[model samples]
Target: MEDRNMKNPLYLQTKMENIRRYSHDALFQFPKKERYLLCRQIEDCIERIIREVIRFQKRYYKKNTLQEIDIELEFLRGLIREAREESYISNGRLADWMGHVDEAGKILGGLLKFYQEKEAGRSGK
Candidate 1:
């Protein structure tokens, strides 16, 4: 039998970790005033994304969780944009951050597609 307790070595998790690290490094550049506001939100969103990736692997019904992750990713992207607009992060940082987010988003899109196809197959049966 397959090992249910085994960790999924997906690149999505790595991407999320990278985002967390990068965001932390970037957040330090933010002024003290924004630290507890926009910075906190971005940090929380990154943490949630990491958590949901693990939950998606463990749960039997994952569509909802995936959708949540998708929303969070979008929110994170928006937060990153806000940072850039406020000049908290530079264009280069924004590019790098967006690259990681885009990669993770693509991995998420694939999982969402797979689960959707699975549901369709079940319904068709």
Candidate 2:
């Protein structure tokens, strides 16, 4: 049986698209008073992380790509917590943002594990 739902570079693209959609909608509803500060920070953090992911992929830095994703995942997790603390986002929104983090982490973890196994197999030869 063929696994048609294979994960490739497009998976990362799809994930980034989701982030962009979420942040764009958030910024739209976010008050103008906090526009430049909170709203922009959220967008910037996500966008920069996405950029790093794309760069790593294009350069084929396999292990480094996973590491970058791990780092950015941590960053996003923290941002969610901080936003919650600052009361910029409601509990529902926090949960929603966390959902994305969880999904991304799972995908990144799978990628990292695959590479780690590959490395182990290579070294055992």
Candidate 3:
């Protein structure tokens, strides 16, 4: 039988691509000191989010993994805000980053809700 997980939509892929592009462009502009610190943190969080999404798709029990993705996304938001306040990124760049992050969060949220409902249904029967 074909793998149902392989047939999953491209939402995760698209979000990962957008985040990688944004981080590449934005991180390059950070101060030398923060380039390794805050910049690295943001990049790591993005990777973690991508990894968690992939795991979520493959696993039967997805709630924990989904929660991890949510936490990583929130961490990213905080890092982006810090970047803006510290003058690492301009208002325009901040807006761009936030837009991408928000899109990813919405997509993940939808997946999370879907799985939650599925889990509830399974328990009900």
Candidate 4:
């Protein structure tokens, strides 16, 4: 059996948590009306990503979940960009948020590669 520590590195989880924290802080700066509009969507996306990340870590079949996380990350990225264009967030804030999303995307890419290789090896054997 894989060690618990090895199975759960918490890297993605930590990154997502940071995103959640930063975004929550930034959302408060948005207009009161936007609190339900764009802000709500962003919050939901982050929560979904965090949930999927946990699910990805636990499941033995990880590829699909990984793809889901990738998709969610992209959606979150788009939403953040939309927020900036709408003037809900500043350019500097957008850059900061994008930095966090990009970091998580890089980590997710590494995991996707590792799993794809492992899956291919199994098929070849």
Candidate that scores best on TM-score:
4
Clashing pairs in 2: none
For model 2, the stretches where C-alpha displacement exceeds 4 angstroms are 1-7
lDDT of 3 by residue, 24-84 (tens): 9889988899888898888888888888877877887778987898899999999999999
Instruction: Give the local distance difference test score of model 1.
Output: 0.86
Predictions in order: lDDT: 0.86, 0.72, 0.81, 0.88
User: How well does candidate 3 score on lDDT at residue 56?
Assistant: 76
Which residue runs does candidate 1 get wrong by more than 4 Å? 1-9
Candidate with the larger TM-score of 2 and 3: 3
Worst 10 residues of 3 by lDDT: 1-10
Which lDDT value does model 1 have at 3?
29
Error (Å) of candidate 3 at residue 84 is 0.4
Candidate 4 C-alpha lDDT tens digits along 71-101 = 9999999999999999988889999999989
lDDT of 3: 0.81
The RMSD (Cα, Å) of candidate 3 is 4.5
How far residue 74's Cα lies from its native spot in candidate 2, in Å, is 1.2
Leading candidate by lDDT: 4
User: Rank by TM-score, descending?
Assistant: 4, 1, 3, 2
Q: After superposition, how far is residue 70 of candidate 3 from its true place, in Å?
A: 0.1
CA lDDT of 59 in candidate 1?
Answer: 88
In model 4, what lDDT does residue 86 have? Answer: 94
- Superior candidate under lDDT, 1 versus 4: 4
